[model samples]
Target chain A: MSLLKVENLQAKIEDNQILKGLNLEVNPGEVHAIMGPNGSGKSTLASVIAGREDYEINGGRILFEGEDITDLEVHERAQKGIFLAFQYPVEIPGVSNANFMKSSVNAIREARGEEPLSAKDFLARMREKSALVEIDKSFMSRAVNEGFSGGEKKRNEIFQLAMLEPKLALLDETDSGLDIDALKIVSQGVNTLRNENNAFVLITHYQRLLNYIVPDFVHVLADGKIVKSGGKELALELEEKGYDWVKDHAIEEQTA
Target chain B: MTDFNEDKLIEEVTTSDYKYGFTTDIEQEFAPKGLNEDIVRFISAKKEEPEFMLEWRLKAYRHWLTMKDPMWAKVDFPKIDYQDVYYYAAPKKKPQLDSLDEVDPELLKTFEKLGISIDEQKRLTGVAVDIVVDSVSVKTTFQKQLKEMGVIFCPMSEAVKEHPELVKQYLGSVVPTTDNFYAALNSAVFSDGSFCYIPKGVRCPMELSTYFRMNAALTGQFERTLIIADEGSYVSYLEGCTAPMRDENQLHAAVVEIVAHKDAEVKYSTVQNWYPGDKNGKGGVYNFVTKRGLCEGENSKISWTQVETGSSITWKYPSCVLKGDNSIGEFYSVAVTNNFQQADTGSKMTHIGKNTRSRIISKGISAGRSENSYRGLVNITKNAKNARNFSECDSLLIGDKCGAHTFPYIEIGNSSSVVEHEATTSKVSEDILFYCSQRGMDEAQAMELIINGYAKEVLNKLPMEFAVEAQKLLAISLEGSVG
Candidate 1:
């Protein structure tokens, strides 16, 4: 069974129709890279899959672990192994990232019929995982994403991802605000967390992120539909040619 | 159908009768159902107070007649009918008891339901408890243990009877009878409250706590509390209160005064959970209180911490007077209003001595069409050379319909004084809630985590027992705020 399957997904935010009959599927141990220009609904698709209420899913179904998850709430989707790393990480004042993660991890564990992790064990795991993104212990003690630099925010997201260890992780434009060094660190953290039982979906405007964490497949989205799909070479081809050709081809295909 | 059939169209609102809403049925004694000199005299005579105290009550009542009910506060309520309310009501069958077992079992059960079994508190925790129901204190636990350490802990009535000289010396020293409208009223009619005196250089061996409750119908509750810490002594006190749910709003006007002498320190905490009306804001407690402390000698310290989560309308400001050179005053508060509750609560710091320092941290959480306001004042006089003060007031709104406001008054007299104030108003962000939810917490859990984090500073100031109860009260008060 596929880890995640979006069948003709259609969604909108407010009065704006963003996702129109988008379809995609990811099996275990696979990395799918979604490349699109601005406003092509890349982030919308990621949010819809994560069950963000900001976008209204008007049609179609989302299946996770071979179970229909379209009707699930955001927290339910997350507990069922769907994670969306926000493009703009939210800064919550007065809530330390450590305390936030403790509640979250225990909640997910509780949802999975498992006992909560003891404070000693949880702190031990957190210390170990902080190294995944090279985050300082002090950063974990601070408010979630508060006063962090752009690089630190991205690294913190990846660190949270490492801690939660979701079966399906969605990175929404994860490489947009990062420098080369930070990008390498974030990508390394993502790579370390990947395994045969889990999958990843990376959404980006530029194909540069595909270099560090190489994708098995690349899908080009335009006008809310997948215009083209190919192997890793497709990303290099699009990077070389720009999106105009893909837009023209998509128009041609639509007209035909 | 066009006759405005209000009752037929909608059901009446009954403010949440919380866990402490259980009422014990007992024979009642009552003073006249009105505020007058005679009622004040009746209260004074019933308590068997001395001539000086009776004279003081008469003075306060006469002054109260010339004053008007304060309306400048941010809270709003219907006009209070002073003539309709009984000035005093006490359980006629109860008498002073030396041991907990002698108290009425029904009264004991009421306290038990409120999560405070004085017996359990006595056995498990070292905290001394003074339990006051309606107009009297029935029992005080750990009196013997405290007496050995030269610490006097008893009801105000008992203290006036047993230690008249001490009570006479310090009763109205911090908060005078003419302090405010409510303070004057409390001065005239306050039936019973806690009284404590820490002897010179003695650190109190255990925490002192008081639980005040209002039970009799149509009776306004007025309580007076006084604590005096002698030279080089230290004491920590905690107070908690609740009332039964009713369709008619009940009145609560209390006066609390503290005096700290040379090198003394006093820490006072309150977790006020009066009944906040139902979802439609029909009925709840009207809490108007005057609380103040005086640091009378050099190097003295006074700190006030409060968690107010109930009351239909709350108008209170716990303040400190820094009279001693090198004294310190700190105010920490977390006020929450939900379901048509309105709270205007904060603290005041008056610096009069050289090198005095004070700090204020307040958090206000509003939900369910309620209004929560933080009103504070800081004054540094000319003599307060090198005085320093820092004030931070933060407001958190849960629903879009709720409101939060901050009003801070700062007055600095000399150039050497330094004062800083910072405030932030924010609606509980949907993104933060979503972030927590996506991490697997439900809405209520996420809301509590965020609210607690926002209130961490003020909550940390409460002792362990009160801290736990305050957190739970905050969670309960904010129910139905989020989906």
Candidate 2:
């Protein structure tokens, strides 16, 4: 069964139709890269999949684990093993990173009818995950993303993703402002966490992040629709030819 | 995602009922429903106070009549009719008991329902609690243990009778009878409160706490608390209160005064959970309180920490007077106003001695259609050379209709004195809520986490037991406040 499937999903924010008749499917153990130009509904697709409330679902449906979940709340989707690494992570002052992760982990545990982790075990897990992302021990005690640089925020998001251990993780422009070193660190964290039982959807405008964590499938999104799909080499082609080449070909095919 | 209706969520949040709203059905007595010279005399006689005390009450009552209710607070309410309210009410049955077993079963049940089992508190925690209900002190636990350490801890009425000299000496020393409108009223009609005095060079062995409750209808509660720490002594005190829900607004005016002598340190903490009005602001307690402390000798210290999450309209300012050179004064507060509640509370630090230092940290949270404000004053006199003061007031608004305000007044008289003030106002933005929700926290859980984090600085100042209870109160007070 597919881990996530969206069939002719139409979504909009207010009067602006951001996702019109978009369709995609992701089976378990497969990484999907969503490469699109600006305003091509890349981020909106990721947000809608994560159950963001701002967008209105006008038609169609979303299924997760072969179960319809179009009406689930954002937290409900999260508790059911869906994670979104925010494009611009919000800063929550006075809440420590460790505390935030603890709450998240416990909420998921409760949703699964499992006992909460003890303080000692939670700390041990936090230490292990922080090590995976190269996040300093000091960051665990500091407020969540509160005085962090762009790179640090991205790293923190990846650290959270590792801690959550969701079945399907969506990275929305997670590589936008990261330096080469930071990007490598973030990708390394994702690579360490990936397994056959879980999958990732990497949303990026450039193919630079794809070089580190190679995707099995690269899909081009244009004007709220997936225009093309191919192997990982498609990313390389788009990188060399620029997004305009794909857009021109898609328009020509539509007219023909 | 399932869409949340903002209107429905707000209605649900605002109508969250008070948990401790049940009234106690015990036989009670009332001083005829009115306030006058006769009522003052009646309350004084009921407590069996001395002549000096009666004279003081009469003086305060006379002064209160001359003064009008101050209307400068940022709150709206109907004018209080002093003539229609009961000035005093207490349980008709009074028993002199040395143990909790001898207390009235009905009163015991009331306390148990409030989650404060005296027996459990006695066995698990070494806190000495002086329980007062309806302006009357019912029982005081651990009196023998406290007395052995040269600590005089008892009810104010008991102190007036047993330790008359001490009471007469320092009763109104810090907060005078003419301090304010409420303070004067409290002095004139106050019935029962906690009284503590730590002897010179003796450190209190355990925390002293007082639990107050209002059980009668149409009654105004006025209590007086006085604490004096002698030279080189230290003491920490805790206070908590609640009231039954009612349709007719009740008045609560309290006066608390503290005095710290040379090298003594006093820590006072309060978790006030009075019954707030209903969703439409129909009925609740009007809390008007006067609390002040005096650092009388060199190197003395006084700190006030309060978590205020109750009352429909609150007008309070816990202040400290730095009269001793090298003295220190600290104030930490977390005031939450939800539904139709309005709170205008903060602290005042007055520097009078050389090298005195003071710090103020106030956090105000407003939800529903409430208003929360932090109004503080920091003053350094000319003699306070090299004095320093730092004040930070932050306000958090949960919804668009609610309001948060900060008014900081600073007066520096010496060039050497340094004073700094910082203020910020922020909303519980939808983005922040979405971030938490996406991390698997529901609306209530997310609000609790954010609020606890925002007020951590103030909450940390409370003692262990009070800190836990305060956190729970904060959570309950803001439940369903956000969509």
Candidate 3:
């Protein structure tokens, strides 16, 4: 069964059309890397799926676990195990990361009709998750993403993803602006959290991330639609050449 | 919080009904509907005060007559008719109860509705409670336990009679009878409040607290609180207050003074939840308070923590005078205003001796169409060498129509003094709220988390017994402002 199926999704921000008939499908145990150009609607897809209110969905039917989630709110989608790791994590001063994660974890537990964890158990789980991404113990007590370095912010995002344990994790440029060392830690964290019953969506602009976390399928998003799909080697080809080749060939193929 | 039905929550929060609005039915006594020498004499004579006390009240009333009401506060209200307000009103119990157990059941229920039943406290932890209704202290609890430690805790009136010298020495030493318009008014007609004195080198066994309830109509609440920590002693005091809802705004002017001797520490915290008017801004309490502390002798310390959530218009500045060498002063506050409420509160720190230090952390949250401001002053005299000061003031606005302002006055006469100040204004961002909501917490939980985080620094300063209540108060204060 498919974990996520977004069919003919049409969305926009104000007057401009951002997601024009974008369609995709991912089954359990699959890692799909959606590589796209700068203006391509890669982040918009993740945002709309996460139920951000900025964009208006003109036409679409998003089905998660065979249930229609087209009109579900953000938190409702979250309770259903859909996670969107933001590109730029919001900084909430005075709210320590430990407390933030505790609230989030307890909230999800309550939604699942599970008992709330005690403080000791919650701290233990938080420490375990922090160690997943090589996060220092001190960072957990500091304000959430407050005064953190760029690499630290990305690592923290992955740490949250590991803790949440979402069924379908959507990564919105999660690997952007990180050096080799930080990239390895983030990818290792993701790999550790991977399982057969869950799926991953890696949205990125480079094939560098694909080497660490190999994707089963590679799709090129351009002009608000997936123009081509192929094996993981397609990412290497696009890296060797530029994305202009994909756009030109797709246009010629469409005309023909 | 997990049961997430936003429409239902919004509907519930939007009803601007005051929870403690029901008036208590009890006999009452009044001095008169006016302010004059005769009225002051009546109040003091009724309480059977010492001769010097009457002289002090008369002096205060005479001073009050010469001075006009100060117009400097950033609040707009109708002119108050001093002659029209009942200067004094007290519950007339036929046979006044002798103890907390024997106190009037109706009175106990009235306080229980406000979450301050003395019986409950006696059953649980031994929190010494002084219940002040209208113009008199009804019952004081745990007096015997506190007395064993050489710590004196009782009503101000009782203190004046039992410990006359202590009261006479420290009563107006911190806040003089001629301090300000409200302070003078309070000194003239102040009826009942808690008074405490921890003996030298003795730590107060338990937290000392006072709960003030106003149930009389056409009356004003004037309370005076005095606390003194002798050498090497430590004490933590908590205060809470409420009033019945009425169509016409009532006057509340209170004066609180604290003195810490050498090597002593005094911690005073207040949770002021007076009735804030309805959403239409019809009626509430005008809470004008003057609270100050004096650090006398070397190495003394004073800390003030307050959570101000109610009152139609609040003009309060809890200040400290660092007169002792190596003395320390700190102030932590969280003032929240919603639905036509206005609050202009902060602290003043004066460094008079060498090596004195002060720290201020203020958090202001404004919702609906309210206005919240932080006005503070930090002064270092020439002799106050090596004085160090640090202040951080932050404001959070929930709605677009609400407002927040900061006014910091810093004076440095000592070239060796080091002072640092920081101020920031932030709105409760929808993005942040969405971030929390998307994590499965509902809007109310998200809002509460954000607000608690914003107010954590100040709330952390409060006594542990009151921190939970203060957190809940912050959430309740911002109920209808956000979705």
Candidate 4:
């Protein structure tokens, strides 16, 4: 059985339809990459699945371990092991990174009917995780994402992902503004958090990130639907031949 | 399996009650409801003030008769009838207590409910508390320790007798009898408040604090607070206030004056949580306060920090006059208004000496149809060469029905002065809320964290005990007002 499944998904923003008849399924331990051009509804699918209010789900069924979760709130989904690494993380002044992560972790624990971790336990965990991401201990006292460089911000997102230990992770353009070193760090963090019982949906505009965190399957999303599904070679093929080839082939297949 | 009522959920998520509303049942000394020259004389006579002090009170009374009420604040309220309230109401307990042991049990219980027990607070928080019930000071703890360091901390009535020369010299120096309407009224009929005098070259041993409790109905509390830091001395003072719930509105008009002599520093903090009116705007306290400090000597400094979260209508401007060369002044404030409350508060920094500096930071949060504003003024005199001033005011609106405004007045007479003023108004974005909730925090916790973060700059200025209480109060003040 699939760990996550979407059947006949249709979504809209205002009156304009963005996702029409979208379908996908991912079993446990699978890593899938959704590659598409700008305005091809890739981000829309990620946001709708994460329960953002901007996109209206006209018709869809989202099943997480065969349990329908189409109406869950963003935080509810988060508590149920869904994580979205935002494309542009927000800067919250005076909220320290350590404090925010601790609170987030405790909140998730509370939702799962567990007691809050003591301060000593929480700090010990933070020190361990900080070393994993190479984040300076002093960064824990500074405001969250405030005055952080772009690379640092992306790394902070992964730091949170590691802290929450979500079962299904969505990386939305996480490599948009990262340098080579930052991209390596972020992908390494993702690779570290992946396990046999969890899945990942990497949404991106380029094939460079796939080189760092190798994906098992690549789906070409065009206009609202997945036009083609293939193995890792498809990403290299699309990168070399451009999206026009995929679009023309998809149109030909539809006509034929 | 469950149905959600959006409106009810929103209401439940936003409504917060006053935490320190517990009242103690105790007998009280009461004065007749009215205002007159006899009432002033009666209060002075009750304190057994010297003939010279009585003469001063009579002079202030005569001047107050000719004064008119000032209505420049943006707050709207019914005109206060000075004749319809009692000018003096104190607990009918003993006038003198030999020690904290002899103090009345009811009064002690009241202080405990307000989180300021005489013995425990002194030992745990290192705060010297002077508990003022209604219009008179009940007891002042830690006077012996403070006196060992040549610090004079007592009630205003006692200060008149013990430190007569100091009171005579500094009284009405910063704010005169003819300053304003409320000041004039306070001058004539002020019952009691805290007075502190730190001797030269000495720092206060502990934080000097005063807790004011209004426990009587239809009473007007006029408190006069004066603090003087002699040359090379330093002191930190904290004040907290609360009131019992009553159907009739109470009046609290206070005057706090501070003097920082040459090279001296004075830091004053206030956590004001008086009863704000209920949802329909029926009953609460009307707080009209005049607080100012004078940096009279060269290199002197004065700082004012306040967290105001209560009152039906608050009209206050804690100001500073930097008259000494190279002196400094600072004001940090966080004012939160909910329900039908209204607040018009900020600060004024007047630069009169060369090389003086001043900084003002004001944060106002408005919710539940409340109106909050920051009105400030910064003036540089012609002789103030190379003076510097910076002002920042930010307002946060929780709901569409509320409003926030900033009115800053900047007047520069010195050509060499540098002054900057910035103001911004913002609402809690849905995106920020969603971000927090996505991290598994409920809406209430998310709102609290965000609000705490917004208020961190000013909240850090408060003393430790008061800072924690103020943080909790900030969260409670925003309850039932956010969704």
Candidate 5:
């Protein structure tokens, strides 16, 4: 059975419809990549799944581990093993990265009827996980994402994902502003955290990210709908043919 | 539907009481309800002050009669009728008691509602606290521990009797009673406040704090606080204040003075959340305070941090006077005004010694139709050839109807001195709100985050416990003032 599913998802922002009757599914232990143009509503799907309030779910249903979670709050969804790595992470001034991650981890732990980690235990775990992403110890003391470089911000997101250890991770344009060296480090960190019981939904506009972390499936979204679904080789094919080819093909199919 | 129903509705609206409107019924002593030489003498006699201190109070009262009320502030309020309110109110005199058993249970209940029950604070935080209810210092905890460190912490009335020589030498030396209108008034009829003295070469072991509340009706509170850090000593003092809401506005005129000797340091923090008036501006406190510190000896330092979010009309200027060579001074303040409240509050830095330095940071948040202003002055004396000062004042406006203004005065008499001042005013932007909303935070939470971020520079200077309370107070004070 599929671990995550979205059936007939229709979303609107204000008066305009952003996602019209979209459908997708991902099985456990599988990585699915969604590629689309700038206005094809890829980011909107990520936001809606994370329980952001701006977009209204006019009609649809979202199932996480076979349980409907359409009306949950952002933090509630996070507590239920869902995490979203923002495309542009927020800069929370005066709140240290380590402090924020600890609070978030403890929040989820408390919700699951578990005791909170002592300061000593929490610090030891943070030291080990931060080293996995090549983050310096001083970075944890600084405010979250404030005055951080673009690549550093993305790395911090993955660091949080590692700490939370979520079941369903959504990566939204995580490779948008990274250099080659930083991209490799981030990809390695993602791969290290992947396991058979969890799944990932990677949203990107380019196929270069797929070169480092291969996806099990690739879907092409056009005009708020998935126009084509294929295996991993489809990502390279679309990279060569470009988005216009998919657009024209969809129009042709509609007319026929 | 009948005429009797209309009468019931009017009665229900007129009888609503304030949340913190409970009063203690133990006060028995009070001076007359006017300002004169006789009233000054009466207060001094009631406290049983020494001869020298009584002479000092008399001189201050004589000078105050000739001085006029200051009108330089932008605040507008009715003239204060000094004769219409009682000047002093204290608990009935009791025999000197050794333990908490002798304390009145009703007074303890009042402190519990103020969130600083003596027994509770002692058990939970391990910090010694002195409760100053209405106009008297009721109880002080942990006296023996402070005595072991050679520190003197007690009520001013007790200090006058126990350490008369020290009181006589430093009482009016730093801030002369003739400094200003409010300070002089406080000097003449001040009832009681905390007095702390740290001896030479010793660091205070615990945080010294005082919680002041105004509970009596139609009474003006004139509290006088004095702290002296002797040579090579260090101390951190925290003060928190609140008042019961009243339909008739009450007056609060307070004077706080501090002196730091050679190689000494003093850190003073205040979270002032006195009752501000209702939405229609019916009633609140009129806070007029004069607080100043003097860095008297070389290598001494003084710092002041305040989070002010109350009072219908507030006029305060907590300043620092750097007198000794190489002394330093700093001020960090965050003041918020909502509804019909108006505040004209900031600091002053006077550089009188060569190589002296000072820093001033002010953050003001204005909402509703309120008016907030940052009025500061940085003065460098002619003899101070190498003085330095840096100042930044920023304002955040939440609603379109409010107003914020900055008035900074910089005077450098010495050509070798360097001074820099910057001021900016900006309204909360729509784009920031949209970004936060897209991240799943509601509008109220987003506003709280942005406001906290804007005031981070000043709020970070407060003690950790007070910082959290100030953040919550900032959110609650601006409720409904924002859309």
Candidate 6:
């Protein structure tokens, strides 16, 4: 069974149609890399699937575990084990990262009809996850993302992903501003969290991330549609030939 | 099932009921519904005050008649008819109670419902609670223990009879009768409040607290509180208030004064949760209060911290007079307004002596159709050489319909004084809410987390128990505020 399925999804933000009849499928344990140019509807697909209210679904449906979830609220999707590593993590002053993660973890657990985690267990989990992401223990007590450098904020995002342990995760431009060492650490965190019961969708403009965490499949997104899809070799081809041929090939196929 | 219709949800949540809106049914006594010299005499006579106190009350009453209501605050309300309010009301069958067992069961149940169990506070928190209901002191717990530490903690009415010399010396000494209209009215007809006096070189063993509740209908609650920390002594005091739901707006005018002598420190904290009327503002309490502290001798310090989350209309400025050389003063406040509530509250710091210093931090939050304002004054007097003052005022608006304003007045008379002020206004952005929601928090929970964080500085100044209560009040005050 598929972990997620999007069929002919159409979405728009205020009058601009960003995702026009986009379709994709992710099976359990699969890693899918979405490569696209600027304004190519890659982020829009991730947002629409995560149920962001800013985007209006013009047509089509989203299914999670064979259940229609197109009209669910953002937090509802989150409670059902969907997580989005924000491109720009927000800075909430005076709210410690540990406190924020605790609230998030408990909220998800509550939705699953589980008792809240005890202080001992919660602190232990935080310690383990901070170690996994190579974040300093001091960062746990500081304000969430406040005064954090670009690399630190990206690492915090991965730390949160490990804490939540969502069933399906979407990394939206997570590697955009990361330095080489920070990127390696982030990729290692993701690799450690990947399992057969969950899936990952990595959206990026650069194929450098694929070198560290190789994908099972690669899809080229252009002008609000998946222009081409293939195995891992397609990512290397696109990396070698800079996305121009993919558009020309897509146009040729359309005209043919 | 978790789909949130933003508008509908806000509508449903904003009109949610006030949790502390229930009234206590007890036998009560009342003086006539009017404000006059005779009524002032009536209140004083009921308390059996001394001749000097009666003369003071009459003088204040005469002065009040010549004064007019101050309309400078940024609030709107119907005109108050002095003749329509009951000047005095108290529970009948009041004899000197020996213990909590002697108190009426109904009154105990009322305190229980308010979650301020006097017994629990006495046993666990070691707080001496002096509870005032309907403008009369019901009980003062832990009085004996406090007395062993040379602390004079009792009801104001009792202090007049037992400690007349101290009362006569300090009453109206910090805040004069001519301070303002409400202060004058409170001086003339104030019924009951707490009084604390720490002897020289003694530190109070327990936190002194007062809980004020308005129970009777059509009655105005006027309470006066006075604290005098003697030279080299220390004390921490807490005040909390609430009222029942009513269709007619009730009035509460209070006066609080503190005097800290050489090397002494006094910390006063208030968590005011008065009833703030219905969604349309049909009924609520009009809170007009005057509170000031005096740093009387060198090295003295005084701090005022308040969390205000109730009342339909609030006009208060808890201020400090840094009179002693090398004295220090601090004021921290968090005022929240929702529905049709209006609050204009802040602090006033007057640096008088040489080398004095003061600091002010004010946070205001407005939601629904309410208006919240921070009005503060920092004055560096001409002779206050090398005096310094720092003030920070921040406002947060929840919905588009609400308003937040900052009115800061700074006056520097000497080149040696250094004064600094910072102000900022912000709205709860949709992006922040979206981020929290994406982390599995619903709109309401996310709002709570963000608002608490914004007011964490001021809330942290409160005592541990009061900090918890203030956090809950912030969440309750902001329900259905975000759209």
Better of 1 and 5 by lDDT: 1
TM-score of chain B of 1: 0.95
Is model 6 an incorrect, acceptable, medium or high docking prediction? medium
Candidate 4, residues A1-256: lDDT per residue as tens digits? 7888988889998999999989989888989999999999998888787778767788977888888988887778888988888888888877888778877999899999999989998898888777767899999999989999998988888888888888888888999999998998888888887889999999999999999889989999999999999999999999999999999999999999
TM-score of 2: 0.98
Candidate 5 clash pair list: none
- lDDT over C-alpha atoms for residue A56 of model 3: 86
Indicate the fraction of true inter-chain contacts that candidate 5 also forms: 0.06
Query: Which segments of candidate 3 are over 4 A away from where they belong?
Result: B1-19, B94-101, B481-483
lDDT of 3 by residue, A163-256 (tens): 8899999999989989999999999999998889899999999999999999999999998999999999999999988999999989999999
Model 2 chain A is weakest, by summed lDDT over 10 consecutive residues, at A46-55
lDDT of 6 by residue, A128-240 (tens): 99999899999998998999999999999999999999999999989999889999999999999999998999999998999998899999999999999999899999999
lDDT of 2: 0.91
Model 6 ranges with Cα > 4 A deviation: B1-13, B480-483
Off by over 4 Å in 4: A118-120, A240-256, B1-14, B95-104, B481-483
Question: Which digits, one per residue and each the tens of the lDDT, describe model 5 over residues B1-483?
Answer: 011122231222222223354556766666767777888888888888888878888888888888898999989888988789888777775524466767877777777776766777777776678778778887788888999999999999899899998888898777799999989988888889989999999999888899989877777899999999999999999999878777888889999999999999999999998877766777888999999999999999999999998888999988899998999999999999877789999999999988999999999998777899999999999998799999999898866677898989989998999999988888765444443433334444555667777788888888787888788767666643232
Candidate 3 positional error at B153, Å: 0.4
Chain A TM-score values for every predicted structure, listed in order: 0.98, 0.98, 0.98, 0.97, 0.98, 0.99
Instruction: Supply the global lDDT for candidate 1.
Output: 0.88
Of the two candidates 1 and 2, the one with more favorable TM-score, higher being better, is: 2
Write down the worst ten-residue block by lDDT for model 1 chain B: B1-10
Which has the greatest lDDT? 2
**Candidates ranked by lDDT, best first?**
2, 6, 3, 1, 4, 5
DockQ of each: 0.42, 0.71, 0.41, 0.41, 0.10, 0.58
Ten residues in sequence with the least summed lDDT for candidate 1 chain A: A47-56
Residue pairs with clashing backbones, model 1: B15-B277, B15-B278
Per-candidate local distance difference test: 0.88, 0.91, 0.88, 0.87, 0.83, 0.90
TM-score of 3: 0.95
The TM-score obtained for chain B of candidate 3 when compared with the true chain B: 0.96
Q: Residue by residue across B1-483, what tens digits does model 6's lDDT show?
A: 233444544564576678888888899899988988888889999999999899988998889989999999999999899889998998996846587888888999999988989888878888888899887888887888888888999999999999999999999999998889999999999998989999999988777899999998888999999999999999999998878888888999999999999999999999998999999988999999999999999999999999999999999999999999999999999998988999999999999999999999999998888999999999999999999999999998876778899889999999999999999998777777778888998877887888888999999999898899899888877775432
Error of 4 at B454 (Å): 1.9
Residues A1-256, candidate 5: write the lDDT tens digits: 7778999999998998999999999888889999989999999999888776668899988988888989876656677888888898877655677766666677678767889889999999899889878999999888878999999999998888888888888999999999999999989999998889899999999999999889999999988899988899999999999999998988899899
Task: Judging by TM-score, tell me the better candidate of 2 and 3.
Answer: 2
**TM-score against native, each model:** 0.95, 0.98, 0.95, 0.93, 0.87, 0.98
